[model samples]
Target: MPLSEYEQRVLEQMERQLSSDDPRLANTLKHRGRRSVGRYVAAGLGAVVGLLMLVFGTAESMPVLGVIGFVVMFAAVAFAFANPHSHEGPQGVVEEDGTVRPAGPGASAKGARAPRSGKQPKAHKPGFMDRLEERWDHRREDGR
Candidate 1:
């Protein structure tokens, strides 16, 4: 359900206060929104297609489309299922019994894994055409 105007106002006030104090808390709040409806549709379509394939007994060829649908539906369902909205105050990090901690020096919780070592490096290989495209992009960005 959508928030009422009054609820929205309250939410906005809370968000502003939270954001002003700790930007990270604000960032987390920014992501709260309704889940995509497309996911449920995709999942339903996939199940139907898979069922049709089964009924037709064309398991070899016709089943491919059904399998594809299933994959798409699974992806959509996964996205929908992985909701980040929580009652937890910020960063989804909460103390036992669910209280938000104020941000401060040494505020970080223990046992958090250090950021992973460099898993990706910039690629240095750009062909002539790629460089030209990059230059074009830069020109557009510069409005020149």
Candidate 2:
């Protein structure tokens, strides 16, 4: 379910408090919002160059050049896949420095807590029935 107005306000307040408390963390969070297009362009160029190298190497009968081209192609693909903005899925926990850490108990390496905001956000655990209901609701919405 969506957060109520009060919950939204509380979350915003918490975010502001966190940003003020740790500027570095805030900077990292801000950086995650968008990615530069130049990186994608460079990756594309790398792939094209690698393809050309592969074709030319094959035509020239140069086995070493063909291997190098394969390596280049692999590296380009790896680089593209490694781009942070390319990730599209459920996110994990936000670490102290705003980097994403895997979700689990005590997954935080720095053991950082939220800055003092005079109020701790209550953690809500959804019951099994509630979770089932939510899934059912989602399925209905999706016309499943």
Best by lDDT: 2
Query: Which candidate achieves the best TM-score against the true structure?
Result: 2
In order of appearance, the predictions have TM-scores of: 0.28, 0.42
Cα error of candidate 1 at position 77, Å: 1.7
Per-residue CA lDDT of model 2 for 38-106, tens digit only, reads 667877888888888898999999988888888888888787657353221256655433566454343
RMSD of each: 22.0, 11.9
Whole-model alpha-carbon lDDT for candidate 2:
0.69
lDDT value for candidate 1? 0.59
Candidate 1 residues 1-144, lDDT tens each?
Answer: 999999999988877766755666566566555445675566667666656655454555676666665665555456556653324355545543355545434344432334446666546666445778999999999995
Candidate 2 to truth, TM: 0.42
After superposition, the stretches of candidate 1 with alpha carbons farther than 4 Å from their true spots are 1-13, 34-36, 50-73, 82-144
Q: After superposition, how far is residue 141 of candidate 2 from its true place, in Å?
A: 24
Global lDDT of each candidate? 0.59, 0.69
